[model samples]
Target chain A: MESEKAKILPFYVLIDVSASMSGDKLDQANRIMPQVVDALAEAPILADKVRFCVIDFGSDAQVRLPLCDVLDQHSSLPSLTIRGATSYAAAFRLLRSEIEVNVKQLKADGYLVHRPAVFFISDGEPTDPEHEWRTAFQDLTAGFPTYPNFVPCGVDSANPRTLATLIHPASGPKQMQMYLMEKGQNPADAIAAIAEILISSMLASGQSMAQGSSGMILPAKQDLPAGISAHSSDDFV
Target chain B: MAAPEEGPVRPVPEGKWQGYVEPFVVGDPGRAAAGVVPLPDESAWDRKDTVLDAFALREGRARIVEVRAASVRGLAHRAYGKVRQDEYGFRRTANGRYLVVCVADGVSSGELSHKAAMIAAKGGARWLAGLLDRTEPADLPWGQFIRGVAVMIERNGRKLLRGRDDLDAEKCDVREVAQRLATTVLYAVIDLHAVDGTHAVHVVTVGDTSAWVLREGGRWEPQEAVKNDGAEVFSPTVHALPLPPATEPVPVRTTVRAGEALVLMTDGIGDPLGQGTGPVGRFLADVWERPPASGLEFAGQIGFARKSFDDDRTVVAVWPVNGR
Candidate 1:
């Protein structure tokens, strides 16, 4: 029974395509897309166990990349553009549909589907009112097997308060991590850090699954950046 | 039903309930002090809940519950600096049984500002718990409560800095550490009652920490002053105050009614009462006009504050459940 549960984790990258993200924000995201895909391809464990999806939200939300395994070399990741108002509600609705369909199909195939993780990067206030997104958010988050872990990364130009509201309801700010990527800091570096966090979390989840528990531990800060070497092994375990 | 036995069945006494509190501290692995002996988990005062005691009360009940959510990151220019300005706080008390919600921001100038902010939160909750033990649910004195909290913080601030080896030689006094570690604390205690009963909210703050009240009618009011015209400029280096004895405490208070939501936050949210339009202003308006869907929604609004502004921010909000 345990072996039948294929430990496949789906990661959804939700990018904000609002007009405010047009300049550096859009360029940085575009520059890092290929790197993110390449990194996943390089990690054999992640390649086998993880799937990727992309949802771009502007005046409307569109799924640029559907759920596909990294090992499938035929899959081509698409470039995202910035152009519309930030309609968070539309993006969330589309994501809910994607998750439900994929999760259902995976389950029927006897594959274990971990609650999908969402990395929502946004830089503006929602164009819609609070009520516009409430019911949809509650329903979507509730549908997950476990509470969905939504990490909303805020750009310096964006509104942090609005980003906070977009995360899953159960998580506190302490659990919501943030990093600032300046104008010249390699976009690939930031993407690498994010990839490291996600991959490391997936590996940790795998270990805990094998041990018959659901505990997960994040990698130390040094281990997260590709070039930075871990100085003190005892610092974090 | 069988006729009651002649002898009264001894009522099962309520079980003795003991509460436990612990504080866990994880220093940034990237910046561990060399040769410094790391304190044992049990020995380190970080994890112990210094304020967990129960008191006897009459059968008729009233209680207050609160929860806080916060997150912060070091500024881009200073991410690797010795002082990493990150926000930290928790929902120290939950609404279901008893709640205590507090959010504090340590002045960045203080070398140990983060530690001070954490200690203030933990200490403030303990102090509030102690106050609740003595006062009745409805009769909670807003003024006295604020004063009591001020005194407790002042005292705790003194204790936290006493005999610290980290003190600077050029500035040898507790006030230096106290002022550097000076944090603005904002907290709310909600008294819960049955459907027909009234609930009260008591809020307190010093410096620029802000509190907002949202009503069932969808109107929101600033519970505390948002802008600090005379706000003290925090200095990383401790300097002697020329104005008055540094021991005086500053206190403010306000009351909240039933079906109202209260939000407490640090300056990291920007001056909610400040001039012109800002994200904090918009957020204050949103919370005032609409009922947050959940605690996460409240937190998300606070997170939105970080995008447009650059400061370590924290917010604690409370929504009392209406009785049926």
Candidate 2:
């Protein structure tokens, strides 16, 4: 028991930086990212086990920060700017490849990696054909070793039903969540809320993982700020 | 009837358990000057077995009960994760008129949160106990009270890290180094002798860990409810020691006569209880209503089929034996 050290709980934030998320949405993402990172950094036990990754998806994908342990992360997360089109396939595919490499790396480093959580934030539907993005989702979420707990957060003009499919979790430790950003609120505040929820959700899940429970146990949808919350999932308890 | 209590029992602690332990923040002499002592040994942390130690204090009416155990998940994961980041302490004033109960939850992300929790709980209990023994301030001085504790922890934390230079409070580098050992605190100062015969319980909270009182008629009132996220407690604006510019503590006052119980707990149990619906809800209700007979019995129920959540759960409870 004295020898048992808590495993690392990795979190990935995937942003869709298509043209639609250009103005306030993208700006808000840049402004609020440091707060999110700071919140995670402020936690004692969580900072120790939780590693963070920020990935951007548009016409192509960008690995802003490869998997870096929050404990060792001294700087803020890389901010995302506007890009071509919302290419879900490019993001998921890149994530799939990254997971294989990163998970292995963390394990090689002697830290038991708990199932990771991927927060997929997007606005509009995929610019790519549905068939391609859907196929990418399958490959990224279903595999031999495992898939991450995917939480798809759809903001302004994004289709909730389609986003639901992206939230399929590969393991019990993973939980399914879909947040719909509400309209009418200040866009900046809304974007900040999104970052807050993601950080909060990740911290909660990471804590559950550290304690040795199956995986992340997120807050109920009702717990979220109004206008954004967990869309009903068969996985919801 | 509950299953017969079974476990290899450790001896009940005598005198100050904290005095024997060194603060993990042993690196800086200044931080060491502040009193952030670490545990004496690893065995002090509960492993597979439940730790239910009731030490009859010489100073006050409330019998101090410490309830801790390896979370079910902690036990299942080959004991990989250290037990939850919950820590509690009790100290009776030298005047023997007050018993201070303190619980601190280490910020999960903070690498040394467990140490923070330990320091907050013990440091607070001892500080308040000393305060009560000397003078009782008219106003609780919530901010100043916690500042003293954090000052000690940071002073000690810096020492533990072996600071290369003399400390500069205004410097971000020094603050960040000390802030590494962050934690949230919820505490209470219970008057051994009541105000005109009504027991007064003063509760204060910084982060999520909470305090509640249970009445004879099965009345349950919480001093603090679970926040939606860390915003209320975790924000830079809010008060947490080791971190600079600590926020004012949330304060609550309630009276408890005989035949009543007071409970202090961290979020591991609060999340389920705050939701208050399913099996976990029922279990919480039962605990308050029937009150398990022993620490092991109480601990068994805490770890019982909590379903999905696995964060450490700690509950420190006190039931007055007789009317003052």
Candidate 3:
């Protein structure tokens, strides 16, 4: 064993694969997923610190990519297809359990793991009852020491107000943010921009860890891509 | 573990180009590539400033203690073309009975935090030495002295940017500038002329800079509270100096028994070394069992790279010679 433990930052790219996202939105996401993986894989320092995962949720949620060091492998990202209705409760419940297991495994492997960050991209409202999803979201976030930074990007018919509720801690320091596509913006363009934001945030966060001052470094509001407006969880509150 | 690896491991041929050990990475070797250029800031004018520095001295009455200290700009800072934000300073009291060493890590967020680190390390050590010279240990007011140090940092830090265009000096809050120029600092005062073989070290820390006693057989016994070892997650937040004048820092007094060394360092070393049982701790404990051949070698040890731990690393170590 290399006895020397590596500091690792785990990032999950959670995407919605509901029937409404069947066309250009889903195609654009599939195309950009590889690019995101490749970009992180190319940077050795960033890759060493970042463990990337992809989870897709429709009526159910499935782990498209297991969390792994980006530097270790180069494989095609599992394609996300149209599934059933958007179930935020299912996504939240799966994420809650996966993160716990993944974080524990990383620690056992002799790595110092920082809080996981989830980049959730959704294109529709949750079909599940507000109570069911809200309960799951609360369990996934509130009072959880290893709760991930929940960044939800709303596109097309996705509700900006509904997405804002997903922000973990929901207040204070505002590590997690919600981004919405402008009313007239193209969904494909919005998906591509979210990809860009995800990459930018990961690179920035990894760079901070490399500097020995570690934390989740979110993109500043001004840095967000055009057509994507960043909102504060405080605004929703 | 087998006796700690012996003196100064030579740099691998591939990494020798950089002089320091090319840090070891778990994945692709190229992950050590250069970082984004840091945008021009207030400290940009001094970009060519020294990135690596060291200090050493041997002093005592009945027992001699060798002191070696070094500071290096972390790879992340180097990648961004930023200057090293960590600093270390030392002073021998006027009476020559005590040695004061201070190490500081400038909070990376502040534009001129490196300057703050310099002031705290150099000025804090100098100020403490001056106070030690005039005041008896029994009468020295520890709490008031630390609180005053915070005030002094605020005054000196403001003075540093006196002529800068951005500052409205008259209206600026003292605590605000202190917060902007925040840095974590650790001070270790050694009783050099101790009658007993054990040299007593009085340590005061603001923020995360820490100290430990490296006992015989390479044990890193932490001098302060160790909170992260068994915790579920690591809290990155730290309390830094230039704190409110009302906050009086506590001090940890420990004795370095014969054959033991006292080590004071910034989180650069502490975070990775964690309880000192892992690779970093084991590597350091073995190599540092005794003093290195020279200050340069000791500096090399301080800069050892492990993946994900790139930060400005600074350490001051004191070892009391038993028979000298």
Leading candidate by TM-score:
3
What TM-score, computed on C-alpha atoms, does each candidate reach? 0.38, 0.50, 0.85
Best DockQ goes to which candidate?
3
**Residue A212 lDDT (model 1):** 22
Docking quality of model 2: it rates as incorrect
Cα deviation at B81, candidate 3, in Å, is 3.1
Which structure is stronger by DockQ: 2 or 3?
3
Alpha carbon deviation, residue A127, candidate 2 (Å): 9.1
Alpha-carbon RMSD of each model: 19.5, 18.0, 5.0
iRMS per model, in Å, is 22.8, 15.0, 3.7
What overall lDDT, based on C-alpha atoms, would model 1 receive against the true structure? Answer: 0.51
DockQ of each: 0.02, 0.04, 0.40
User: Which segments of candidate 2 are over 4 A away from where they belong?
Assistant: A1-237, B1-50, B55-79, B163-175, B195-197, B216-219, B229-239, B244-246, B275-278
Model 3 CAPRI quality: acceptable
Writing each residue's lDDT as its tens digit, candidate 2 over B1-324 gives 231233444566886343242321111122112222222225234433334544333324443322222222222222233445567788877777777888777665555566777788888789888777666633667778778887777766665556436444444474575455677777788776655646678888877777767666655567776454322111112245566444566568887755567777776666555534334444455565544655555666665432223456677776654432
List the pairs of residues colliding in candidate 3: A44-B31, A45-B31
Scanning candidate 3 chain B in windows of ten residues, the lowest lDDT window is B21-30
Candidate 3, superposed: residue stretches over 4 Å from native = A1-7, A41-45, A74-76, A107-113, A207-222, A232-237, B1-30, B33-42, B45-63, B136-139, B163-167, B194-196, B227-233, B245-247
In candidate 2 chain A, what residue range of length 10 has the lowest lDDT sum?
A1-10
